[model samples]
Each structure stands twice: as C-alpha cells, then as structure tokens.
Target: MRHYQPGSVVQMVRDAIVGRCRHIAPRTFLMVAAAVTGLVTGVTAYLLKKMIVFVSKSVIGIIHPDGFSLWFVLLALCGIILSAVFQRYVVRDYVEDGCSRIIMRDLRERKYYLKKRDMIAAFMASSITLGFGGSAGAEGPIAFTGGAIGSNLGRFAGARKSDVRLLIGIGAGAGIAGIFQAPLGGMLFTLEIMAMPMTTWAVMALALGCVTSAMTSASLAGFRIDFPVGSFSDFSLGLLPAVLLLGLFCGLYSVYYNTTGNIAAGLIARVRTWWGRAVVSGLMLGVCVSMVPMLYGEGYSAMGRLMSGDYGVLGVNSVFSDMATPPSLILLAGAVLVLKGIAKASATRGGGVGGDFAPTLFAGCVAGFFFAQVSDALFGVRLPPVEMAFVGMAGVMAGAVRAPLMAAFLVAEMSGTYRIFFPIIIVAAVSYATARIAERVIRNVKSCAERAR
Candidate 1:
C-alpha cells in the first residue's frame, strides 16, 4: 500500500483544537450548570410529590374509601378504566422506560426535556399506583426522568462526549439524593449502579450532584426522615454469627424478589395487550389488597405496623400461617408479592416508566418477618424483626441494584445509626457479590447464544 497523505496529520490537529475548546469551558461554569440541574430536579420532585399525595389522600378519599363497596363501585371502575386507557393508549409503545431504548434512539441530547416529562409522569403514575392502589415508589420514576433530562442536555448543549456522559450520571445521582434525602446513598448509587465502570471523574461528579441535591431537598423539606428503614446495634464479637447470617438470608430474599419480579413481568409482557395486562393485574392485586392493606401502595402502612411491634395478623412479620382462615394470609402475601411485581415490572417493561427500588424493601420486610419467626423457633435467637427488617430491605435492594454501598448507607441514614455500619457492610457485600455472580452467569449464557446464532 502507498504511504498516507501528509494532510492526515493536519486533520488530527483540527479535531484536537475543537475538543480543547469544549473541555476548557471553565470548571466553575460546569459546576453551576450542573447545580442548576439539581435545583430544578429538587423543586420538581417536591412539588410533584405534594400534588400526588394530595390527590391520593384528599381527592381519592372523597371519591372512594370503603374498598369496592356498592358505594365505591363506580370509583373502582373509573380507576380500572383509567389504568386500562393509559396502559393501552399512552404507554403502549414505551416498553421498559429503559435507558438502552433511550440511547438507541439517540436521546443523549434530549435528556433535559425527557427529565421534565419523567418527573411529572412519575408523580402522576405513583399517585395512581398508590392513590387508587397499585403499590410502587416515586424514586424510580424520578431517577429515570432526572437522568433523561441531564443526559439529553449534555448532547444538546454540544458538550464533549465525556462531559455529556458525566452530566447524565450526575443527574441520576441528584435525583436519588433529592428524592430520598440520602446523600451518601445517592453517590454510591451512581458509582455502583448507574455509571459503567466507576471512574474517579464519575465519583466526583456523582458526589457533587448528590450532595447538592440532598442539601437542596433538605433545605426545602426541613430535614426529617424521608423514608425510615431500620437499624441495629451489637457489631461486637458477640454478634458476628447473627450479622453474617443476616447477610446470607438477605441475599436469598433479594434473589427471590428479583426472580419473582421478573417472572411477573414476563407474564405481563406475554399478554399482547396493555389493557388486558392492566385489568388482570389490577383485579388480581385488588382482590388480595382487600385482605392486607399493607400489600398495597408503597407499603408504608405495613412498615408502620412493623415499627409498632405488633405480632398480630396485621403486623409486619405477621404472616397468616393458620392453614385455616378464609383467604389464608400467608398465601395472600406470596400472591401479593407476585402481583405487585407485575404492577411494577410491567409498567417498567411496558413503557409506563419507573424503577424497581421499592419492591426489594417490600420483599425484605416480609423476609425479615418470616426470619424473625424462624430464628425464634429454629435458631433460638430473638433477633428483633424490626431492625433485621431494615437489614433485609437494604440487602435485597443492594443485590437488585448491585449497589452495596448505597444499600448499606441508605439503611444507616434512615435510622441515623452508624453503630451497625460494619454489619451492614458485610451483608451488603454478600448480597452484591452473590447477585453479581448470578448476573454474570446469565450474561455469559446470552453471549454464548448470540455467538452461536
């Protein structure tokens, strides 16, 4: 082959100059720009949450409070109708609200706009899911929307590729922090889950975004427990076995949540019609929801039950194990988990858009309750289910998202207790490692299939 032309060197130099101009835009400017992203996200999340809560509490209360009685039949019908319409018509083509789809469509530049829509939509969707009773969290929706906006802005603003990517990451971190009011959790969430490889730059930006958003949210919300999980003491030599066992058990429960949730999503996906899926899911969930109101919404009421230390049927770990009873409460919890998984997974899979963060906590609480009983009978250890419930919540959440640090930190922040940090770390590590190994197995299988094809 002939030698390359001398102008090749000139072309390379031209590209370098353009890149320098893009990255050299002052650091101060970038920080301020990114901080604006946090500011807007914080305001939006706060306002939207209030509106959703108001709708759920005030508007819905006035409409229907007596569970599908003849007095509330029309309201239930309207709820079903709205659910069907939105699933069928509006979010029909939007399967998964997945980042992969957004990227494939070249939405890097359109992220800012997407964030706005996502935030508002998450607010409305969460309200509907909770208000009339679908059972989910606003965190996922908020995160998705925030990430979309930040990512799109980068591309649209003509920033360097690295800058765009970093900004997108920061946006996701900001959303997590702002909504949850958990700074360390938000930073770790980005590093372990959102960012691809966890680089130094990503850490810096993520930390900045999280801190900024959390502070903004705190200032506005007056710094209370945004969402309380659980906590424990006794990280000393005496409690090693219990702590380690907690981790192992939590990992197993996380696996259950992930596998079962996926199964529900698969079922919904196969239905071929969004309305059919929605109606079926809604009805299935509705029937059981009448039994254990804890199985509905974000399950905050269930959490309250746990905090109150009541071991009765309505209590946190109070699974109806009687084998008698009309609609067996034990079977009811299992069925509710399956159905709730569908409501959450299907929405994400079908394009209604959101995340699976809340499901793990629900599963964890249930497992903690179950394990509490097991420990008392089998192991003869009186592990307080309330505290262990938080551990389970963190562990499952860590495993599902592959964010061990965030999971551990989330529990600590919720309880304002650092005494159990060491144990939390251990449990988190186990949950994350186990889930990662499992994920790799699936990934490798997929790769092998693709190569064979």
Candidate 2:
C-alpha cells in the first residue's frame, strides 16, 4: 500500500473481482451467465437473419428477379465454392449438422465444447448457402452457433461439465426463440427434441434463456407473427375427422421425406471431394429450381403467399379458365408438396450448410394446402385451406421430429392463437403415432430382407 502504483492498483481491483466471482454459488453464477448468453444469442440470431435478407436481396434479387434463372445456378455454385474454401482454410474438418451432433454428443458424454472458429465458420457458411438459394433453413446453424457460444462461455466461467451441457441447451433454445419469437417453443424444443432432462433447474435455465432471447429479438425485429393467416378465425368440431386424416397423411409423407433425405445424403457421401459434391449438388438444385421456381431458398415467402391465396406470386400458373377450380389447384399444390421434399433433401445432401426445419415447414404448407383442396373437391368439406395448412405444419413437425408437444406449442406460438390448440394436439399425436408405426414397419421389412439374404 505504501508503494502503490496505478498499474498495480488496477491489477489488484481485477483480482478482487475475479476472486469475488469465484466465490459466488454455482447456481447463481449459472443463472447470471444464462441470462447473458440468451441476450447474446438473440442478438446473433437477429443479425444473421438480417444479413441473409440483405445478401439475398443484393445477390438473388438483382441477378434473378423471377426466382428461377440461370443466374440462380451460377450464384449457388459460387456460394458453395466460397463456403468450401472458408471451411477448409478457416475451420478445418468442421462437422456438418453441428447442432444435432452437439446435442447428441452432449447427451451421451455429458461434455460440450465448440471452438470459436467453428462457430464463425458455421454462421458464415449458412449465410452464403441460404443467400444464394440453397433450398435450406437457418435455424440449425443458428442453434449450433448459440450452443457454441454457451459452451465456450460456460467453460470460461469454470462451470461443471453437466452445467455446461445445460448451458448449451439454454443457448440453443434462446437461438430458436429469437428466430421464431416463440420462447415456449424454444424451451420445449430444447427439452423435447434435445431430450434434456426436465429437472426444475434445467427448465428454469431454458425458460430464462428463451425469454431473454425472444424479448431481445422482438425488440429489434418487431413483434410480427411468423405465419399470418387472418382468414381462418374460428374452429369447427366437424374438422376433427379431417384433421386426423391429415395427420395420418402427414406422418406417411414425413416417412417418405426422411427416407428420401437419407438416400440423397448417402449418394452424395460417395463423392469424396468437397468441390465435386458442391458442383454436382448446385447443378442439380439449379435444375430443380428452374423447373419449380418456388423451391428456391427457405420457401417462407412462398408459404406466406400461399396462405394469402397469392398462387401466381409463387409462379403457379392457372391452367383452367375458371381459376377457382379446386382440382387444378390441388394438382399444382400436390406437385409442390412432392417436389419440395426432394429438392430440400437434395440441397441438404449436397453440402448445403442448412437445416431441415424450414424445409419441413414448407412441405407442411404444401400438404395442408393440398388437403384442403382435395377435401373441398371430394368430400364437400369447405374447410379453410389456410387453417389446414397451419395444422399440417404442426403434424409434419411432430411426426418428423417425434416431438408432439413441441410441434403443437410452436405452431400455436407462430400463429399467435390458441383457438386451434385442440386440432393441433390431435394432429400432432396422430402424426407421432403414425411415424412410430412406420418406423417399426420399415425396421421389420429391413430385418426380413437381411434374413432372406
């Protein structure tokens, strides 16, 4: 104290703060860290989204206004090449689908760590992929990035391995909540899909993270509902049977979707070179986009247009003189439903750094629209297609991810309505049941085939 210098005083104060932080209870420290992580994750999600939009407008909008042009192919090729270069040079041997893998690893090993370079590489790669019409979604990469941030932060704070895993979930949930502006959905997604134990502390941490992220995102991006369907106001008891049927169909479709994705991924995996895989996938995706322009990118804008009955905007030209014919519309919508699954699968398989969440939602929209049209045509059911589309979204998500509660709550939050909760629950339950049955059947078939061989 008698020989105190300015530098020594600053160092002493820093040491005192560090010492105080070290003495803080683990639970209190976790809670505080989680809040900060959520805020940071929300800001990251918002900025990434804005960047995608800006780049998309600048690259795709200026070059290819009609959604499907030769420019689309060229731009996609360039994006893929650039992503490969970045991954190779900046983040060596980065894992694909990093979020899902991280969650699985954390569950199995109860340890989590993600390098800062990997996080940056994922964010950059996904932005480039989506910006150039890669036919994928941003949710997966964002979630992974959030988890990386949380894991690194927790490690720096000297958290235990188990608590670090929980922190990863907290950050991931915050990312989802920020993107969708649905805090409950984000929390449930982490708890259900990630299979995190539902301890009170875990739930508290996830909830706090999701709420903070959602609030931050809302403040920055405004509180606009994700999917706005204003035409469907009321629910009808007569729709239960129809909703059940839709759920069953959605489950079957989900199985087909999963199968197609696996097949495509396997085929693409045979190509050893990243550049070759990127080029081939880019070319194939380009051809598909040229044929069905609506299949480009995340397909959210097209879904919104479909919900609002703006089919032309989606490049669906009417063939019949009477544009109101349900059959013609049904055929177009069905084609989209089928093609979209294939295109999205192909895109993901071909080195596109994106997630299946948005593509699944896109397929759900097509299925719901097709169901409404078919029911009106065949069963004389005048159910609103927009409402059916929303239900289909929940059903497909439940089946594909096997998380009915998460799907139901997510759709409800996205729609900003509790009016359709009953139908959402019914559809989600049935879809989940159907998907499980389908999985068992496929397993049995495969076992029988192997035995015969």
| Highest lDDT model number | 2
Per residue, candidate 2 scores C-alpha lDDT tens digits across 1-453 of 345577687556655655676899877877887898899999988888888887788886577454335766677677666666667776774545445665567658755876767557668888888887877788888888888888877776667778788888898888888887889988987988787775787788788999999899878988777787774667788777899899998899888877877776677678899888777777766766666667778888888888887755445422222344566677667666666666665565556677767787888878888888888888787878888888888888888878889888888887788888888889889999999999999999999999999
Query: In model 1, which runs have C-alpha deviations exceeding 4 angstroms?
Result: 1-24, 63-119, 152-161, 197-202, 227-232, 308-343, 346-353, 436-453
- Span of ten consecutive residues with least summed lDDT in model 1: 68-77
The C-alpha local distance difference test score for the whole of candidate 1 amounts to 0.60
- For candidate 1, write residues 238-298 as lDDT tens digits: 6667767777777765666677667866776677875676655555455545444455456
* Number of the predicted model whose TM-score against the real structure is largest: 2
**45: Cα error in model 2, Å:** 0.7
Cα-based RMSD of candidate 2:
3.3
What local distance difference test score does each model get?
A: 0.60, 0.77
Q: Which portions of model 2 miss their true places by more than 4 Å? A: 1-18, 316-325
Worst 10 residues of 2 by lDDT: 313-322
